[model samples]
Target: MAEDSSWMTAGAGECAPSAELHPEIAHPARIYNALIGGKDNFAADRLVAEQLSAAVPETVAGAKANRAFLGRAVRAAAALGVRQFLDIGTGIPTAGNTHEVAQAVDPSARVAYVDNDPIVLAHARALMSGSGHGATSVTRADLRDPEALLAAPGVRDLLDFTEPVALMLVAILHFISDDEDPYGIVKQLVGALPVGSLLVLSHGSGDLVTPEQAERAERSYDPAAAGIHLRTRDDVARFFDGLTLLDPGLVIAPHWRPDTPPDAAADRLGIYTGLARL
Candidate 1:
């Protein structure tokens, strides 16, 4: 590999998808991007985001809190000498991306971002194309198919399976319904990685929201869009089963080892997050 900016497109082949982008429908990636104040989303995504926000006034703040949690977690992993990252369900790239946080710790860090949406793949390619540092790549792959994702060239190219890797599943697992066997999916991905590897994840929670608010929020994600399935703390904790959970296990997103003292509003984020070692 020539490295340098050349490595920016090192895994371009992995992100190409046969499915076309459906701009008319609301997509999870675009909605999240819009919540984070990114310009990559369409009006459909904005509608869904606004609907959710109206139902749960705290949603926009919650989404930003989730992003902050991601940054803190990635930086913590990087601090622990994790130079490689496999970030699945990586939505539209915004401020504090995984590679940005990891590379801040070590310039040579490598990251492979995976997402199923074609629009996300396109925006990811554009946002990341010329980073000119670290081995960063984007791939279009479904999180449900861990086998295919693990076999993707983008992952195999940018990350060495033999070493300790940080697998990030931030705010994405909720898209998977119970019938999808989400736990099994996590197990398959974690089992493939070497010993001492880490699993870092954040998921949506309905513990704080009223039933009416949760139902209204759910309606925003129509059948055409990726459906949301919020779980409770106990349900979210199951994903970290069989792995050693780090301190402050499975708390609301902003409360997880915050760089600054967490405020009372941090509890209203309506998300749970944790880091675990295999």
Candidate 2:
């Protein structure tokens, strides 16, 4: 992708909040970007990725697997006739973005990409500006505040609460610590959706790693803006409470209706994913 010098500027007549590029601090999204072989991150982010990868050699593969799960889940939702998407904690723009995949299935599909990271907002805006799909918006919001996130102008404008929507929380809920009430946050978001809406989520886990590896991975993310809180499979399942999980419920990322056959060790890769209906 070519660098867009105007990415920092909101399009004519648009008023989106701007964020500072704090390159010195490690951000979870940027760290994820680096892990996925993206170029939109900084040295601090790369350091976290390097340290985490060193501790758990499968870190990169796990990240890629999580991303793949997002694509498959989105495609499945689109194919199911859900036309609106509310993708929270959207990381930096990359291949097979929510809108790209959904719109490919149905050009009329609409997506609202929400994230607190300024870099992600900038890139999303740039992506939206050039999008021929026409029904996309980027909102700067934090998942910790579900009410505010649900009411953000971009989200409310692009998505209809009365209609079925696919709420995507892929590879992001792990960043929310228990103190932040991650479950409550998800509940609020889901409750706001209609009965037919779907929740697509993926979370990191420590279940497959030894205590030492988990500790080392935690230490690597100590300086990040949000610390990684790998949850048990049961803990992750709590996020789907009051909702019915779709086919292939709560499996490892690669095993969640995989497009291709998964390797034997795919279950040990540490990311649990599921798609559910309200």
Candidate 3:
């Protein structure tokens, strides 16, 4: 899809200062956007995406699979009667966003999108503005600081803690390194949700690649704000501890309750995805 310049025009004033965006450095979200054939990215982000795609031919396909998993997971949550959603590490607005999918299931469903990236926040705010979706709100917050993220006025105001919520961490955790205590971060956030809440998560895996290929993929993010940390199936499964994993638990992205038969290219994708109930 072409880059929608309309978001920039609508949210020009809301965008962060040039210094904050750091267009010279590649960000995971922006690179992912580029990999998915999006135009809202800088030269640096595109370069990284190109390098990764060259090394791993399945890079772009993997990104699309991850996005597809997110859509299916959200629809499943909505079908299960989840009316509230807290989506942290939300990347730049794209099609089939959390609010779009959830609200499509039930117009009254509320969605709170949290991301530390100013560009993402600006675009999200602009999209929500144009959609006239009063139940949705966007907040600028980091996943590393769950306390502040959960307490942000935008998040607190729009979501009721007493009710069930769909906590979406899709395609975001891989950006967090081991020192950052990714597991602890997830546990803290999941702890805050009421019983019956769901956790929708997807993370990149190195299991399908050779050591050399994995190294090359990691190097592609050298210029970015954060380095990639691909995990094993066991490591990724730990994130869902204490929750009830749904059918086809903790499988590769394309295999998780696939809406349609996955093609040959789908097997080469390296993302692991699953949904669990609290």
Best by lDDT: 2
List of clashing residue pairs for candidate 3: none
lDDT of 1 by residue, 1-278 (tens): 11111113554443244446788899999999888788888899999999999999989989998999999999888877889999998988888889889988998888988888777677777776664646888776788778888877777777899999999999999999999899999999999999888899999988898989988888889854689999888999999999999988888988899888978877788999999989
**Residue pairs in collision within model 1:** none
Residues 1-278, model 3: lDDT tens digits: 11211112112333242236888888888998999998889999999999999888899999999998989999999999999999987899899998889888898898888877767866776676665464777777788888888887667877899999999999899888898899999999999999999999999988898878888998889734779999988999999999999988998999988889999878778899999999
Candidate 1 contains a number of clashing pairs equal to 0
- Listed in order, each prediction's TM-score against the native is 0.93, 0.93, 0.92
Off by over 4 Å in 1: 1-8, 11-19
Off by over 4 Å in 3: 1-19
- The clash count of every prediction, one per candidate, is 0, 0, 0
Better of 2 and 3 by TM-score: 2
* Whole-model lDDT values for every prediction: 0.84, 0.85, 0.84
Could you report the Cα RMSD, in angstroms, for every candidate shown?
A: 3.9, 4.1, 4.9
What lDDT would candidate 2 get against the real structure? 0.85
Model 1's TM-score against the true structure: 0.93
lDDT of 2 by residue, 1-37 (tens): 1111122112324655466789998998899999999
lDDT of 1 at 168: 96
